[model samples]
Target: MTKTKTLRIDHVKHPMGLLSVHVFWCVAFIVIPLLFILYYMMIDGNGSLTLDNIKYLGSKEILRCFGRSLIYAAASTAVCLLLGYPLALIISRMPTRRQTTMNMLIMIPMWVSFIIRTYTIKNIFNDNGIINQLLRSMHILEKEGDFVKFLGTPGLIIFGMVYNFLPYMVVPIVTSLTGIDNRLFEASADLGASPWKTLLHVTLPLSRAGIISGITMVFVPAVSTFYISSTLSGGTVTLIGDKIETAFLNESNFSRGSALSFVLMILIIISMLIMNKFGDRNVEGVAV
Candidate 1:
């Protein structure tokens, strides 16, 4: 009985069993949709899995959309990091009560309807909007023309992405930052390390995993987002999401859409890999 128990424990601890379980879980969720798309593609992908379909994706417009989506996602992630990091740092330094209150305020926006908020932003950026009115009234602008070009531009889309994903970045960073022992910073200070050096050497390194997670969460969704960009940029900004929508709706081609969607997934995987590579360098001491 003792020998059998030991053998069972060894078998259960084998890496293969754990790997199989992990693979099964992944298949149950991620792989299933991909398999469905693949099966659909093989069955009705433009009568044949021809290079023409692939070539079509290589067209200037589609390529441009793909690049634009990457650019937008990257820009959004950068903006979110810049804006969220300091806010999270400030919250981390606050007393427990104040931090809780500030966190609630930060999350309050998430409860709002995304579409409604986006439309409100559109109104704010419209030619006859509050900003333009304020600028004109204050004589900051000689005329109502070219005040900021907020609407129907990349800037608005970037703003929308930053506004929406700022919470994602802040939450992760705060989680990681709060996990850090405050004594480490105190010790660094006692050792005469400058504030910047302490952050660079200690705080920032400890929060790397959170930074990577936030970047991934922000960038991937932003890349796939269609409505925010379309609404803010007035349908002029071509993105990979726009291509997927057009293929599915305008072209009435599910196969092409699935293919484009697959490509987008690939792009996300690549982006995640790149981010992980950078993040892993300092992740050794960071808690999961």
Candidate 2:
């Protein structure tokens, strides 16, 4: 009888050297920058942190801006969900060829610069904009500038947000909807469930994970966007984003701005945590 020799298998542990490279870059680029911002804010203060900084932010204008930002964020998110859910469902049900094309079309908007999109919206809602001209041509309005105030109002901010963030909602929902096992629906149908019942009971429940992800993606960013609010609303509106910008640029009050920024960060983190805790089970999207 011949004796057979088996080769021993060796497991290679990841080198700490390679891992250190990643940690180095992360700390250098992300962590250090954040710490610097905080340090700058502290220096801009009266050489130390103080309650006066918080009290300063409580000024009427700043507080109002923060409150308005929250309201606008909430309203925009609601609108995005309303429109995005149906659109995603429709897109998911389309033929593969059509679905691919439509997805490309949706993604095209993302390739455009955010500032450009906001300015484009500003133009469309302007007094002498194409919308007013078209309305006048159609005799929908007897005047050109009638109700043209949409350009510099909360309404326009919300509209721009919905346009920009619609994809955030749609992409997640489409992913979730498409990943759903068609057999589940078939099984539900076989069990004497109506199509509507299947959608309500099975389809919707399965899509909750995507819905949560979409809401967090859209809501958090919308709540923090300053560019869209300032540009589209002609600087009339104040959002948390605008306040942060103002703190850095206009007032030279870096510390208070940093504190406000820290607060904003905290809010985003807490909200995301709550959202994930509520819907983490349903997530099925590929992580980057």
Candidate 3:
């Protein structure tokens, strides 16, 4: 019994043993849960195999939901890229202490509960909220019923996405910018490249990985976010997430929910592959 216990301890300490443990947990948690999704995707309420769930996604209303999700996701990502790239560049060039402080400031918003933050925004932009109150105080509006209509608009929904997800975009790009060798900039200057030219050639290409990473991080959540749309737009904006949510929650249609989830996974996977292809292309031979 002593010898057997000693042998068991040694096996547990082995590298392959650790790997085996990891595999066991992954199969139990990740793989098994995914199997459930697949099972539902292929079966109806009565547990009979059916393709109807898959076909439902191809319907016009569902297609419109998907299109809206893609558009909102793309728009939010573009806005984040435009805003975050410059902000990241600025942060990367700051003194290390300042960089840390600035990064914390950027991250502080995320520490707040997202639902609470959304409600805070809701309060600020509601019909009798701060903006309208201030505007009315200044006598900028004559009509009592006239509010700026900030809530329940496409723009506000996109703004909420950008606000919530901006830190994810900024941090990755900052890491990438800071990783780039400073000598590349010197060489570009020595070769008589202007500041803008150096930035376009030397800086952007090197930072492609972070840009793609940020895009993926933000876009993935933005596309599937039901809360932001539901809260900010009051369910007026129906993205694919709203559709999937409605299927499962309101309709109790597990098969339809799983099918929508499966297609969304495929769509996101295909997009990531394309982005990674561009990000991984060697920039070694670009003229210095």
Computed on alpha carbons, the lDDT of every model, listed in order, comes to: 0.82, 0.82, 0.89
**Model 1 worst lDDT window (10 residues):** 1-10
lDDT of 1 by residue, 1-288 (tens): 244444454575675554665677788888897897665444454465555555666788788888888899999999999999888899999998998898899989989977888888888887878888888899988964747677777778999989887898998888888888999999999999999999898888888878888888898889998878888888888788887888888998887787788788889899899889878755764544
Ordered by TM-score, highest first, the candidates read 3, 2, 1
lDDT of 3 by residue, 125-163 (tens): 888999999898888988777778888899999999999
Q: Mark the regions of model 1 whose C-alpha exceeds 4 Å error after superposition.
A: 1-30, 42-47, 141-148, 284-288
**Can you give the TM-score per candidate against the true fold?**
0.83, 0.86, 0.93
lDDT of 2 by residue, 45-103 (tens): 55764566667667887778778888999899999999999899899899889988988
lDDT order of candidates, best first? 3, 1, 2
Q: What is the C-alpha RMSD of each candidate to the true structure, in Å?
A: 6.0, 7.4, 2.8
Which one wins on TM-score? 3
Tell me the deviation in Å of residue 259 in model 2.
1.1
Q: Clashing pairs in model 1?
A: none
Clashing pairs in 2: 41-255
Which residues of candidate 2, in runs, are more than 4 Å off? 1-11, 37-46, 58-60, 143-147, 280-288
Which candidate, 1 or 2, would have the higher TM-score against the true structure? 2
